[model samples]
Target: MPSNTDISKLKELYESLDRLKESGEDVVAEIRKEINNIELQYLKENLFPEMMKTLSRKISWLRCSVDMNLQFNGEKQLDYSFCKSGSTVFIRDKYECNCPNEDILEESEMDSNNLEIITSTSNQTDAHDTPKRSKTYTLRVEFPNGKVFQGNVVSDTYVAVIKEINPEKVDSVGLSHAGVAVVSQTLDSKYAKYQKPIGGGWYVMTNSSTKAKGFDLKTISDELELELKISLVPLNNSEEAIPIMGISESERHRIRVTFLDGRTICPMKVLEALVEVVKYAGVDRVRELGINCCADNLILKNPAPRYKKLCKPVGNGWLCNTCSDTITKFNQITEISQKLNLGIKVELV
Candidate 1:
């Protein structure tokens, strides 16, 4: 049942066991320790979803058709081996299960408090194991329909599949960005029938195949290639920002707050409302504003009447389109956050 990555580690562990035995070490005890070490590592990170699936065992069951392969070199990829098998997979299912398993592990309050909300992936690769540079990069993709997607990339080779959203597929996803082309429609597509905003949708990008860091995605297709040229935009609300077409005001700039105490607030507030959050809810108690939980407030940065640096008929008494005067606004926010000792982040969805 081991994956390729797991088999590799198991082989290394066997070699270590042999070496330890030859050195007059207690082979049985030493191997036990070695196996325990491996278990500890897997406990730290489950590259496979086995544990997660098991936790949801009573919810629903599915299976994965896995293909295993090994190759020594590219030139002689002919020198390869492979195996295929069917595996029963238990994953989270949409059908609400009122039956709760006492043994089911839920994220603890402590864990929720420490949970990171905003995580960025990168797409750069280094072949020679060069020293890693602490480089942070932002990714922005603006659709011709005035829809903008923004995020940070922390990995050099993190690739996202750019799929043109289809209306027929719209009734099949909860995230609004799912039901992609490269992937098969999920079982929950039926659940999407109840979703609102029926019609043509924006082109969306979701995680795709990854081979190496710094891989050229253009090789995939013309559509995939164009995704790499996404323009960068300021994350904070800008004075002259263009409203992303199709997305609602509540959907675009709204803030969703989640606290460490297992509480959540989906108040449709906005840009300056972050200050009040810190004032009311102290700094450390606020777990997150954007990631995981619903956003805390709505900046209403999009759905502009017309795209402009200082667009007309601006709401909130200001243009939400320009990149101008960001420093001052950020300063004001920073001052408020610092004064209240809050570690709040203002994110635009």
Candidate 2:
């Protein structure tokens, strides 16, 4: 999950470090430190969360199923099963009294057979029930250049809306949620909540009803023609903003920034535009402007210790606080452009 680029960079670093070690260079320590950083980033970004999700799903399946015969440690054929006590699950012998046992088995104690049973059972259940849960919804895809495609899409419990839009292009594009580009492989139900059975099937994709911001299609593949702003309207009627297509006016309007070099970035949110501006006019230059970068609970640069949790790197060793309202983000961009003397025009289209 560390991406091909990360893997290539790590391989190069390791080879360089080995050569440096043979040459008796002190730079070996720096390369080793960088390798450690990449490993830590992989664990943080991919490994840990994936492990947790897998564990959680297994536990949930076990809790829902009745009388699971799982062997512990591969030595004892214990007729153990899980029982729910409020929110916590406790293990108990299948033949024993209905009381929950105090002792709980760790994941390490469960043998490969036990894990296999759980995984297979979960998959079987999903495969069996998916067809019954399938429903049709209105799919309206609007591109950055103002091209729109309106159609109907049938979705199962597992299939995402992006996949339903264009199965071949799903890998090339992703949907945006909370200003973050959510992978196309993620379950649609995870982001868009099913409101009712209106207009074939209605689902809302906005901050109020859902975490979905809009379609964040990327031109990562040659098959994808357009790269800029794309919006997927989930409703049959665009004017009525309830039950389906519940995006606010701000979420609907795309922010466009024109730089001095005749390069322009349009159909992005305020925060995204601000991040691009910072990337264009380096972090050091923005700080030198002596303008207050902090807005709402966000500290754009030079964040205090308390705000560190809310900050993410925005190039050049600078952190941008992500905790801010939409309106505050717009104001901050305006202030940043005015103070930097960049004469960059920020417009909402």
Candidate 3:
């Protein structure tokens, strides 16, 4: 059987077929064919490979058992060897023969080499054992409009989770990167030891000796005894980020944001959250909220160096000092939400 992750993907794919049908697209047959291809891919890449590994281990164990039984029963010494052909393992015996059959001798030599390779693989498997099964975790996605979507997802890579949650936007490079970064940051904060900081500011999470790009969401969920809730916020286009305490310095650690319509942008720093709000609320509306437009410190056309570090470009060659503590950012978001009549929420996690 395919893993839960693969099953979820298939389910989503099937659901999309229904959506396509409703949209009057005649590609239902094409999509069904694509689904079949995906299923075959999953079988070959995941299920079949896993089954082969298990079968190989069992065969090795049984062969050893048979050899021990033969020796204990006082049977004559017999050569036991196996060769892999395609997906099958063939066991054969090599006996001493004075016959001049060159073909037989060559086949025996090939089988012997295969046996050695299998033995080495079996030894390595014994040392490492099988990989741990991925655990299923409850996933909750909170949209900016207070809408919530809930589902069960397997503990896998951040990219995989996003694909399951928002399959439609998986192809969007900006949203995919933003979603992965948000999920990675949350996992890093909770399970720092399991996360490896790789190039491009991405974090790979794993519990095994081998490095993996997927974090164990099930472990975190189990520890907290709660479903993993991901809040989608909004961000401006020109927003940038600055590292703060207890957060990763990587650019990928930027807080993920999306438009109210669910279009996501690149994640930005807390300092840029205010810029996003100001852009959304319009400069005139922001000034109406008791903010001085001519001030050289905070929201102004030209700011001093001290305040400039905390500022970001907000169109029309204007700069706004949005860089501040998390609490301040939250308060600003709240204020903008109230004054502009927008339901905006910016959370650090």
Candidate 4:
């Protein structure tokens, strides 16, 4: 409210919405949308654009670790095979890194043989304050075709300056890395094994180009066979997340999570929250979970009797089966009235 709106009015609005929600009124979304509109108006409606700008900045550059292999000062040309190798297998690419490297390193086609690794004092800094010429980093990335690619997030400059580029790789997902069970490799490993997971796993990247190759929405969709589109949903911008916790149900891909507090959330946001929860407890904890939610009450009643279906009455009630059954219970009721105790009939007509 920016300390501008009247406090009493704001409190009244909040309480009214809470009451409506508690009473099982299905107007929460509409009410929340209105509230967002009000806040957006208060912000001069720049919230959407500003949020986009912030998200763009965060995705612009990502940082991570990488592996590097470089042989200094060798043959004029470089030749190498980029393929999966070792207990820790990494994907390969035809053309390697696009990051800037030393200027002396010459560029050539991927098939060129008799290559040399170029090193320059300016390209690297040594322990003794001396410049040495070796720089390399293995970046993590996934191709559009769902193949993971990991190599030096090096620049053209670095590749051109280095030589003796014959390279081979080993597979990490298979026994090449370790003949360990899935449980041991996943849960017992030093770190989460990105390889051999259903969904793509996390990867390391040292430079911008490498970071670009890491798991992204496209990579996920390709690996998981699910379509994904980055979207900006208009969530409540209030500093407080609406406190809600509930059982979630998914029937025909329509999921609903109803909190004990009676707040119902759509599956999308519920799934988002679940991601955070899973991260906190680890995947194993989440796999062992089941959710419960409140069910709606149902009341059953017999069909009403028609006048044409009624038979002649035996006493004070009609003889139709439905009508007679209803009258019999009351007619046979014990008399709490003093008149009935005196043998005066208290009739229910």
lDDT of 1: 0.34
Best by TM-score: 2
Q: Which stretches of candidate 1 lie over 4 Å from their true place?
A: 1-133, 145-147, 153-164, 167-182, 187-228, 231-349
Tens-digit lDDT string for candidate 3 (236-286): 223232111111233122333455777554344455566777788776566
TM-score: which is higher, 1 or 3? 3
Tens digits of per-residue lDDT, candidate 2, 214-253, equal 3232222112544333333344443432222233343344
Backbone clashes (count) for model 1: 35
Candidate 3 C-alpha error for residue 286, in Å:
1.4
Candidate closer to the true structure by lDDT (higher is better), 2 or 4: 2
Q: Which 10-residue window in model 1 sums to the lowest lDDT?
A: 290-299
- Ranking according to TM-score, highest score first: 2, 3, 1, 4
Per-candidate count of clashing residue pairs (backbone under 3 Å) = 35, 0, 2, 35
Worst 10 residues of 4 by lDDT: 291-300
> All candidates' TM-scores?
0.19, 0.29, 0.26, 0.16
TM-score of 1: 0.19
Q: What are the RMSD figures for all models against the true structure?
A: 23.4, 18.7, 26.6, 32.2
Worst-scoring 10-residue span by lDDT in model 3: 65-74
